[model samples]
Target: MCPVCGQEVESIYHALFKCVGAKNVWELWEECPMVIGTENMDFSNLALKMLECGTPRDMELLIVVAWAIWCSRNLRVFEMVCQGADQVWNHAISMLFDFREAVKFCGLGPLACEVRWKKPQVGVFKINTDGATEVDGRWSSIGVVIRDSRGEVAATLCRVLPGCFSVDETEALAIEARIILVRELDLHQVIVELDSLLVVHQILAKDFNGGLGHIVHGISGFLEGFHS
Candidate 1:
């Protein structure tokens, strides 16, 4: 049962874009590029298309709207509280305004920051991974991209994991999977990157305590074989 509306099975796309609650919030931004009746597009494709076609301000608002939807979903799922569409819209707008103001105050120009890829050292490969979960905790996926020193593709892996209770567990599972891949390929010297700071810290700490402690412990053992 979906936590928000108790309808169809919850998925990342549905939770973020297509649910009744999500649709209401998007309709609030009728003038936004994403709400212009684009059909049959998944969340990842929609996000990429927005980045390709949207202006800087459009991009900012789009990100805020997505975040607002996620926050609203969390509130409903965790606290059994539902926020109105207007409230969600207002919150996203306020957040975007504050972000823009902060950028101006710092004299860093209009956009917040642009992220790009950097190559690893000559003998090392880099593995980047990220995890996503549905708001209702019904589904989850992990993505991994491996690149060599010359910035050439090595391998890519994306897999759906058994449902978990929290996103941190999903992230920890992703790191564990990436380590397995490294071991299978006999890649002794490598650098792993992930967006979850907590997972990185846990891996570096070499001590594990949490729902993901067992997974992190496995990763710690794998790390011991690599040359520092």
Candidate 2:
């Protein structure tokens, strides 16, 4: 039964991909392909379809979406917080993007998201980063890890920043650290992957803007070393 609404016994299908509540969760996007005839389909098939048909970026988005949907369901079942699919979707993207930025700081890029889904193979280096802060007698931290193609650990670091800071800044800092580490190792033709679109774009852009000069400068220097 729908514990929140007391209407009917909601199957996993209804709760995850088809219910009114689920629809509300993803309504912000132009549309989700899964909503069409989503009934009577298995979750594995749904994931397969998403992977078989979508671009690399789309595949990454789907991973976050599926994860968010699962998260919402767990929260609803245990905590009674019926998070709408739209909100869950947004949260999924935000979390994934921020995570990407953090991992990329260590010189891992799109491949990090891929390795997350596919698991890292032998001979790849993965770097994980974390940030911490003290709040009202407690410490909280957020961390992300990146692995190279062979799934080896290249870099892992955590910071206790001791104050309030947005996840974005931490992500940017992580990227900076990753790139610096990569330069120190002096590997030629290494693949650097990151999850944040903003950080990726900033790193790839040829010109440096003023506001994030330190980060941009660091990344630019790394690239110069790589090219030289």
Candidate 3:
């Protein structure tokens, strides 16, 4: 039932590192490992061995390449789109290049580091949301937490959504879910927190595109109720 190679494979490791499509990518890679993992090995074990076998940079490259493979597989499944192994490898290389550049540049600035979450005002509540897709891309899980000024949990939730969703779409779903939950509770004022800057920007501008955009519009509509 695997989409990448048209195989009835159930192994995550096989899908990402051993299948014909995935193998094409690794073979195209300049430093592909001869012994990445066996087809039947668990993904966690393979990942642990990879971590133990390489430098931090090596680990980062492995992760990025693996992510590219997943994206490629998802595109093939959900969109009926296929990118050659060369293209997938190039995409990952580009991402890794951008990431290294960012890290290098960010290391120069003290203010470029991550910031911790702060509590909202006394009268307002804060809702934080996050979403992550599973390895096979068939499921996405979202987590939402609502906290009051005293840092007490007002409400918390977790759900597994079925489908292959883009990262943006998944993040937008989390925001939408959070908005709906808060609205249902009739909370007057609430501050939302999410890590997806793209979604945040799109929402702030009231601009959206495709499936993610549709979800954002729904979220924007819900915002109108809170102004009263």
Candidate 4:
């Protein structure tokens, strides 16, 4: 019997593909043809078929998801912990996105602008924020590092958040938390920096009432307290 779920005999197919937990993860990835057409085939056959039928990106995602599921299984067995299907799915997609970004950067010739930290203006404080989630776990964390114009750390905060639906949501949470931290510190003149350009753009736009509308609204409210 499988030590993790105890629902069936331990086998490669059962452990990786057929278990209830694995099925939930596969169902979330229904956009993938391999996931949509899962059959009672052996593990190797299923993997080979995925490679043969999937596009390059699809294949990459498939591999990442499989690896995530395997890692989740191992974590459950050894650490007595389990990750939900949504968490596993989000983790796989995030990994694939990071891999693709890295490949794109490597493909571009040397002129690509390198990112480096710069100090804030003389009277302004800078808050750098970031968020990260675990591939084989459910929770996410947001961190904020506040620095003065002299490039010295003023304050720092780290928080563990519940499982986020996507990286964008996690980033939004980070910015929101940063705003709250600024308010608590009474830092009037401040600048915020984060790696996610999408979140920054969304915040800059005047009318952004999409999925993260509430978070954007919260950020706007907090910004009013800052020195213009």
Candidate 5:
């Protein structure tokens, strides 16, 4: 029904496309490549198509705009949260700039962009410790924490391994992964510590007789000549 007639209810299509209420939104999207003309666009298809196109920066902008549009739409309908076009534009601007700054600081340039990896300065040796609980004779989870000599946290990592494994195996695997990651960053001078004495001893001995033999073998080989 027309506004003059005072319609009782409005459909999403009418509100999003046909209504005067949405005219400004359409115009805004026209300027925003991410959500422009996406009213009737299939969400999945649009996402994939956009992903296929554009550099990393372009994709980042697209993601922020798309998310902002969806947020604005949801705010208007279900939550009864509504804001003017200026507010929405401000929202988009804030999101875009923030994400842009983050990506830049993280040293993640454009997709497939030429990036020279810089080695981190080695201040002190660090070790990331981890644990995995046993449940029902099957492995539950892995918890990892990295710390330097001063007891300052360097990093922490955790994840559930596929299939079942013992706590010792999980700990060993975490230590091995940390060493590889550190080596990739080209920072080799550091001490590795683990609460699990067996894992630490195994690592020192360069022995892979444990359950996670393959992983230990590879890691030991890589760090074999490094000063402990």
Candidate 6:
């Protein structure tokens, strides 16, 4: 039986593909493909399936992220250390980032919403970003959504970083993360729509010497790449 879910027997494919985003949905549903193995396949077949999923870059990231997810599962089952999905995904991304120095290395659902959201202009994508700081002030969780002109969800990300940051800083981090996400998706001609008015002013004014100096500056650099 799976230590995490306890309802299903975990296999190699399950352990590797049931990534962080699907962690929450694991509790009640079998609908998440990432959380539930699509077939009773062995390792060779699993690799073959992954290769057919996305672009070459996506394949690399899948391998790296899968390794990190497997490690998190082991930690939870053996050491009894529990981590939120956001934290797990953030750690996996860091691992992928570091591996590139040694050797070049690297969810689902059209996360929909009921609330009314405005779509962007033709050929452009609008990305909305938000973040929440932990009550103890030790961690921050970020959420982002990207939608094309047609209002179709392009991509979404939620990650947790270990830090004690103010509202603006957390918001800035959220913006920074989408930079990585959009680039990986090869997205340009974008419009960033953030909830933090301060972050908006700072970015528009090109002012980066306040509390969010480091992250804000990096975000500015990333904006230069867009077709907007």
List where candidate 6 sits over 4 angstroms from the true fold.
Answer: 1-116
lDDT of 5 by residue, 121-164 (tens): 35765665675644233444666555555666676667777644
The local distance difference test score of each candidate is: 0.76, 0.56, 0.76, 0.77, 0.56, 0.67
Q: What are the per-model numbers of colliding residue pairs?
A: 0, 26, 1, 0, 2, 0
Model 6 accuracy (lDDT, Cα): 0.67
TM-score winner between candidates 4 and 6: 4
Consecutive 10-residue window with the lowest summed lDDT within model 5: 1-10
Q: Which ten residues in a row are the worst by lDDT in model 4?
A: 30-39
Highest lDDT, which number? 4
- Measured against the true structure, the TM-scores of the candidates, in listed sequence, are 0.52, 0.43, 0.58, 0.72, 0.40, 0.49
Q: Give the RMSD in angstroms, all C-alphas superposed, for model 1.
A: 13.4
Whole-model lDDT, model 4 = 0.77
Instruction: For residues 56-157, write the lDDT of model 1, one tens digit per residue.
Output: 778778778888889889977785656677657756765565566656756865454654789999989999899886554456799999899999989999
Candidate 2 lDDT (Cα, 0 to 1): 0.56
lDDT of 5 at 145: 57
Q: lDDT tens digits, residues 1-228, model 4?
A: 987678889887887788888888888875776553357777667777877888777767767888888988887887566768876776676567667777788788676557578998898999999988654446789999999999999999999997634566688899899898888888899999877655676788843565556787888888888884
Return the candidate ranking by TM-score, descending: 4, 3, 1, 6, 2, 5
Query: Model 4, 7: alpha-carbon shift in Å?
Result: 2.6
lDDT of candidate 4 at residue 74, scale 0 to 100: 84
RMSD of 4: 4.5
